[model samples]
Target: MNKGLYFWKTSRIPGKKQGIILAVLLAIILGSVSGWYYLVYIPHKKHDEEIQKKKADVANKIKKIDDFYEGQLKGGGIEQFTQLLNEIYQSRMILGLTSYDEKLITCKPDSCTFGYEILKSHVFNVQKKIFWGKEYSASFSNKGINFSGIPSNLKDNTTLTNYRKKRDVAAVDCGRLLNYIYAFNSISDKSDQIIIAKPPASSVLDVESEVKSQKKSYGLLFSTWSMNAKNDPIHIMSIFERQAFKESFIIKGMELKSKALKITGSFVCKSGK
Candidate 1:
């Protein structure tokens, strides 16, 4: 079958009514165009804007990670980022916008260095709060610990320093013992000795330093007379976790007997895995 185009012819109308009809038709066309602008164009424009924003955020993250790889991102990016990477396979944080961990001695493109801390004072300062002072001295099973020798928050750089010049940094491994004191951890003036053992001289020996595959490790062991206070000494500080930090503060063993508490833990003090 063959098909042919058909045409329709209409008679001419008056110009006055034609203008009104033309105006209506023009209004409909404009309305349709405006509708398209509001619906499709506007939505796509907004979507593109969101995509660009996301791209910008991704670019910022990429730059940060690049800085970290290039060793331009200093601070604890090496240590803590490595730790996060280990966890995520490990994971973080666009190399962290800001790194607060201070033990990272040096961060380089090829290799990084971490400063070590003698945790004797780290644990001792926390111990002093529990055992020192007139309030706590009276509540000790022994003569009580005299904290006159060491001030609070003083970390030891005894073997780690050079020629009497100590590394003046509050190490990343600073809060080894303080992690146990949940209630009194952040407080500088620790007045309450009710929740923990006394300041009966606590110490953490640097068991080993970091090797190729091996990281620096520490062993913390201390014994103190039970506090002559109202609360059960060890019950409040329920520190039974294997590792309080990334690779540090591993709870090894704990003992309590006859108003005396002994705490033993492995603080594998290192940058990361």
Candidate 2:
């Protein structure tokens, strides 16, 4: 009886050992799964979050570019175009388009050779407005705004036989206007304080030329300036008229009545944005 009992105990010991081995294997499998959840699963989730953030940033940049082009296409007349130009100018200024540092020095000193290329492009762009965009003729800059491009309602008005004379005057006026206003040094030297403080009159800034070709009427714009220039301290006078229509005029109460009307109507600055 004792011998039989010893054999049974020995067999039970081996079975108990097998059970312990199985328990150890089960614990390892659970630990591996938990580790995967923490390391692999959580890390992948974070990577997805980062990717989403990058996509959002790209979307915002694209939206801004789209809005800019849309505004350009709308033309919204000269005032709107000028306003857009001013915004771009201001952004470039803030971004240090001409320079790299906070000193506000031009790109020349900063070795940013790209500045020349950008400025050249911008100058040409603005000049195009003066030449062809809308209301004021290319001659307005030269021959005065009163010059008529098409002389008469007469069918055979061959008076344009001297088209050369007309063209010459238009060219001269355009050149003179550009010479007075398009000086790079002069523009750069002009105080930013003035640009920020004073804007031009509503009419000048928001100008429209009503062109009546037969029964159809269309509004066009040639050029636009900063309405803020209206309040500038600098005395600017048109070369042809010699009338101080900008900063000086406002200081002298020339626009008192207009100002009153604007204020009474709760006039909001259109280009404030």
lDDT of each: 0.31, 0.29
- Model 2 per-residue lDDT tens digits across residues 1-273: 999999999979989999999999999999999999998999999999999986775565445433432222221222222232343244334433433211111111011111112233332221111112233222222211121231111111111222212221111122333344445325443422122222222332221212122111111112223222221112222221232111111110111122110000001112222
Across residues 116-145, which tens digit of lDDT does each residue of candidate 1 receive?
222332331112112112222211222122
lDDT of 1 at 48: 100
Instruction: State the local distance difference test value for candidate 1.
Output: 0.31
Candidate 1: segments with Cα more than 4 A from true spot: 1-13, 72-273
TM-score versus the correct structure, for each prediction:
0.25, 0.30
Highest lDDT: give the candidate number.
Answer: 1
Residue 34 of model 1, lDDT score: 100
